[model samples]
Target chain A: MAARKSSQSHSGGLELLFSNQRKHKVSIPSTSDATTGQPSNVAFLIKWLCDNLMRDPRKEMFVLDDTARPGILVLINDADWELEGEEKYELQAGDEVVFVSTLHGG
Target chain B: MNGFSGTDHQVHNLKQQIAATETQLHSLKLQLQQAEQQAEAARHLSEAYQGGFPAEWMDETLVALQQDVTRDIAQKVRQEGGFEGAPSVRDAAQPRRWPLEKHEYKRYGRQLIMPEVGLHGQLRLKNARVLIVGVGGLGCPAAAYLAGAGVGTLGLMDGDTVEESNLHRQIAHSTARVDMNKTQSAMEYLQSLNPHVNYNRHEFHLTPQKAIQIFEQYDLVLDCTDHPTSRYLISDACILTGKTLVSASALKTEGQLIVLNNPPRPPGDALGGPCYRCIFPKPPPAESVLSCGEGGILGPVVGVMGVLQALEAIKVLTARAQRPANGGDWSTNGATSEAAPKATLLMFSTYNTPQFRSVRLRSRRADCAACSAQSTISRQSLTSGSLDYVAFCGATAPINLLPPASRVTATDFSRLPRDGSNVLIDVRDETQYAICALRGSVNVPWTGSADTWLERALASGLSFGGGRQHFVMCRFGNDSQLAAKAVMERTQTPVAVKDVKGGFKSWRDEVDPSWPDY
Candidate 1:
């Protein structure tokens, strides 16, 4: 199976789930979706993270309906994921994907 | 025998010499340690107490004198410029003065030497009028830096009192001022830090009616509040009053900051900066929201954001407040420039290897409810008290999820037996449960994504015996109601579920007086 490496970081209380470690390196088996004959992308990476990196039992907080949650903002290469193809964008080797929740306390 | 005796004598003499030398070395070592400590004391004694005076008198006397000096500075500001609740001096009794003073050049000499901030740039800083809303963690440090830099006017607005819990992150308040109003306490500190900057104090909370009039008096606005309702309210007010906004928020180990309305223009102008709504179109779910008290915050994490706010405010003001070098009443008004600030969200996380991250943000959205051509928010609706921000933000109020029949008093719940038949489920989060809990209580947080917590408990061999009761408790009383209702629905077999009214608070008052309040 082909695999690719990506760096993922979480912040704003989202890190509480991932063993409280903010940054991690994950190698995803490229094209986990052999059934659909689809290339590896953000959706594939998220499922890989949920299965591997999520130390907490409640997966619903980080992923809502199989994508990054509503309040969380995703950045792909320092640009908003919305500008990219969102979950459909194909993952490139050594890409930096960040997820952050909006903070409302001071 | 003679030879043996002679050898023994020689060895005994050598041993005595070694023992004497070792004792001497130890005493010398002790003397060295005393010298290290006494050297500092020796110097202080010569300067302070060599003349037959008590050792503690100098420090105590100096601190008391310093208090008097700070008190005088605050009194001077109150007498001359006035303070909290004092009406602003709109119609100047004297003509506005704009000339840079000799003392000002000396005070700002460090920054004035920079090419970016020479005489003219310094003048711009001296001419800017900035309004800061919510004088707490973000405001304290921001105000200190701004007042030190000689901002022409600094207006402070807040309606909170200082608490023992606030001292760690909110640096402006003092231990002595625990119950004092936040604005008044912060004002005293700022007045002493820089007496030159004009201080305007509005001791009340920022309301829709007061916001427009207060914001109209200043050129720039800073949203330092800790709640989403205030964030929405402040942004709407800034949009209405045509003031540029620098907003920031910090919680737990992270913080976010952005600049809005850099060149605050009319609605529908795509070139203008985006307000908070344009970016965060929907607030987070009400149940998910957590305060700094509920969710712990690092002091330096918030401090970094607050200091950055001061830096951004200064850069925006100095760049935008410039005027014709000639002389035409330039000091009497706000900045004349209309430059747009770059739209980027600056994120800071304490635990990340790269602690700072910046993301390019999109401009104003066409369908934004507050700042669009077909906008629903207007000055009339805002000031006329028509906006129900509390409901819109899902407000931080006590949620009534169940009726009285389902809830029992904490005293009544205390009467239950301690056997395994009666279950006491404490729905507080894990952090709080670690802090303190009753002897026979179990914790399953009501706020988490554990919808099947009850089912999991049943499958794990927890019993709900016949005629036994299930008591639900939480920090206050709201979460217990929700937990009790969920337990009622989750269980297939009929069981008695009751919420402990007032939760731990009433339990402390009515049952155990020694329970830790925090």
Candidate 2:
């Protein structure tokens, strides 16, 4: 995990917060966009999450998956992802993305 | 005239008077007929009320009165005054009385003022029949609001008994009714809230046989249940019976709401909104599933969803009454008579920057097994026991895979020596560990890794001279199984490691009665 963190540069990277409800609760520090230049869109953020945070990226899926899995919901900067062009919406500085899973029992 | 005789003049005058009297007699006869018809309608209405003026009776009465009553008078009344301003045609119409007592009006006065709900919509609410599947956190609030809103009939279905631990979120159940069956407890609470609502208590688990039959009686179903199997069952039953389903689920600090299988406009034009299967396609893997008992949940999160469920149910029930002109707006209209209900999913979170989000859901799936045009599920299939919802949802407890030697029943564990040589590790989180645990168990709290904790325990010098024996347990046995397996594989020392079968639940059942289950 330390090696992976150091492998990526710290300059002009996104700050990501994973909810405690998720299996991974660690807050990512200065996560650089692997696909494009700094300050990318939601699509690149998802790609970065898949590469870094998820324990088993091959098996685990995210809210952005095309199938629209039942349990998870995603919001971009206090607005519904649907209203913000979903994956196509570009991430701005100080943007907050939230993922909530409604799978557990009441 | 001068040529005619005086007697001929007298006869002409008499003929004119006779014609005038005959016209007056015809008018009197017409008035009498109208009076008689009104008398007959009044009699029917009185008899209908005596028999508990049913919804069908109201429909029949509306048709009859509309046909027989003079439309001229009704039209004149409407022109003179609207429904709210003064007594309109609707007030004069016997069928539109809605049977709400004066106090009922006073009670729901605030709701009655909303244009979308007025007298007509309130009547629909009083006529609605809603079934709430679970009486836990979600069902408690949903049922309460529906009852408070004066929904005519409310069905409470739950097999479990109330527990003290549930009082935090299950607001409908009181500490006094701790041991009572959930449905019975909820019914008591709802009845107290509003005695006018007809409470139906289903004190048994929902089965396929009962699901369709019970669902058939209700206009809508609220899937307030937590289990995935019950969710599938309720959705399928709603699809088969043509009942709207307002399904909500909450977990941890987030919740979801969706209205599924709302009856289509024009009846059978096409399959209604998407069923749960269309949205999920399949249930999440069993290993990933967690209950509130296993994964702690906040009270207000489920409360918010429950309240929303009630709102959606009200929207579905009163939709036709509030139907707008121009075929109604699907986006804003709660219930509409024209277009398909807009399928949308609402998601809410109470943690990490609270957010509420909604996304438009896809239309009904042509290949949806439960609600499609050529769907496999049907009333016949449901009643014949052809559809195994539990199997479909993968809700049955998964088979334990560890070898028999690697597991010990709580009864056997109780008999094992409690000497310091034997180490019992409670793998539940710290919050749960603080709740209660075995007398000598140490808390490790499974966090996907056992090496750090195992090394710490080894360095503590708690092990005996001989090989050490370790037992791992959780609130339920599932997590402990994995923890125990990890301990066995990772430990360098020769240790006999086994998971406590059924975890603390089995211990409470077979080992000790005083231990707290939650």
Candidate 3:
């Protein structure tokens, strides 16, 4: 089976749900983008992360429908995902992604 | 005689040797390139191992690579023939002249031996003035490490008093110190850790007018405060005073850390590191903010982040110390240096397999309101108390969404009939509801959102006082009010639904002080 790879890490307490594996070398099948119906992009990445990574029962913390829940900042290669067209940005090999929830409790 | 006069025979022999050596050199270069590639792979594999287990279900090449890496790392653990002994410190023998006090060598010897922090770096730490704001969970641990490291002048600023709840995470403050001013309690603990360092206690909250003045006295500031308003104020003050800021926050199982104003570039300078405003641009909504009491925090989760703040502070301070005071090409903002730290945010999740992550951050924004070239903030406005941080961040005023008469005082609540005819809906989440609640109260949890518990209960033929009275309660009155409003709107029949003002907090205060507050 053909697979495309991208790495992602979780922070801001989202890790507790993803089997506590902050970084995962995900293997996405050579499938069409879940949203765009084209090549796999971050939209596919989000769905893929939610389906594969989450080990905890609380899936609502990291995901909401097709995109990451609000307040979780996604960085594509150290740049805000928003600057890179949010989930529409095409997935590239070796893309370093970070999903961060800005925690305020001290 | 003619042949002996020129030495052409010896020159020819030398040329022949060079031709042979050149062919050998080409092979050696090819071998070196292959070795470099193997080393790169080994390094990547080691990093993966450090993060956690490698994906075993990868392709054949990756599986083979993992085995190779495992073997390579095992070989490194043991040197040829036997395990290598620890390397001796470079200055095992005392120098003729010593700058640090005699005891200081023994005090900081472990860290002093590090190459990054040698004799010169120790002196910088000894001279550095650091101000830690908010002597709570984050500040308590941060102050401890900074003090232990012997930062010459450590100033702790916090107006809060230590309480029993803080003892779990505020490591520096003991049970005996509870009720004492946080700064004073921490100062006592920090002084015990390192008597050589000076400690200053500013037992007052930081205001817009006082922030810059207090910051002016220090070279670096640690923002351990729990709120967005203080965070913004601290960054602005740091940028205004040209002092570096190391900030951290943690909640539940996750934490975030960032170093702001590292170059301490004067305000209006685009070369400076991004200020808090530059990165966040806007504060999180006031209603979204949650205190440690409301959200709950893990002890080590915040402790680790605070420790990272101290580490980042050490990195910044020591690097600055190693450079020359004035003439240094490597120590400029916006300059390229291999050692220059990329603007990044470090995130940690205690429950995650690889708990730490570093995300590269953009430099100062071109239009930041605090640090950009077109910044609106000025020292004049800050010192004169003209800047309204609360207004800017949108202070969490009391939740006044409901009209009067819908809310009842805690005293009024206790006086109500408990004949089991009236329903007391505990609106807090399940965990809290299990902790403590009014006797015979029904649990219909509210998660700060539109809860379906009321609808579910109503549809299941559960009588809400049979259309007489339904009471809503939460840990705090805020959520209860929201829940009460939801109930009033959801019900078809006109029913009396009143939110107990101040919820259980006021219940403990006005009615029964013995009720568990946590």
Per-model TM-score, in order, reads: 0.74, 0.70, 0.73
Supply DockQ values for each candidate: 0.35, 0.27, 0.25
Q: What lDDT tens digits, residue by residue, belong to model 1 across residues B263-368?
A: 6767776656788888777776665677788787888888888889988998887666323357532221243334333368999877666788889776787888
Question: Which structure among the candidates has the greatest DockQ?
Answer: 1
**Where does model 3 exceed 4 Å of error?**
A1-72, A77-79, A82-88, A91-99, B1-96, B268-270, B321-341, B451-453, B456-465
lDDT of 3 by residue, B1-518 (tens): 76874678778888988966765565455445445655565566456445442342122224344444444433433322136454433321222123456899899999988977765567778878999999988998899898888799999999999999999999999999889999989988887889999998899999998887888899899999998889889999999888889999988777889998877787666656778887777665576566788778989989999999999988888777224437752353235554323367888767665667677776777788888767899998898988899998787778877888888898987887777667788878778877887778878766434445566556645565565687888887888888888777776777788888888989999999999977
Q: For model 1, what is the error of residue B236's alpha carbon versus the real structure, in angstroms, after optimal superposition?
A: 2.5
Question: Which residue pairs in candidate 3 collide?
Answer: A20-B352, A20-B353
Which pairs clash (backbone N, Cα, C closer than 3 Å) in model 1? none
Among all windows of 10 consecutive residues in model 2 chain B, the one with the lowest summed lDDT is: B89-98
For all candidates in order, the CA lDDT equals: 0.77, 0.69, 0.76
Q: Write the per-residue lDDT of candidate 3 for residues A71-103, one digit (tens) a residue.
A: 578899978775688788988878888887777
Residue pairs with clashing backbones, model 2 = B319-B335
Which of the CAPRI classes, incorrect, acceptable, medium or high, describes model 1? acceptable
What is the per-residue lDDT of model 2 for residues B1-518, given as tens digits with 9 covering 90 to 100? 66577878889999988976765565455445555656676676667567554454455445445444566344433444343354443443343233457788888999978866665577788877999989899999999999999898999999999998899999999999999999999888887889889999999889888888898898889998888888888888888777778999887766888888765322233536778876665676555567887667889989999999999888777665323346852322444355444478787766433367676665566677777766777778878888887787665465485899999999998898877768888888878888886777888776544565556555655452366688888877887887777766776666688899999989999989889856
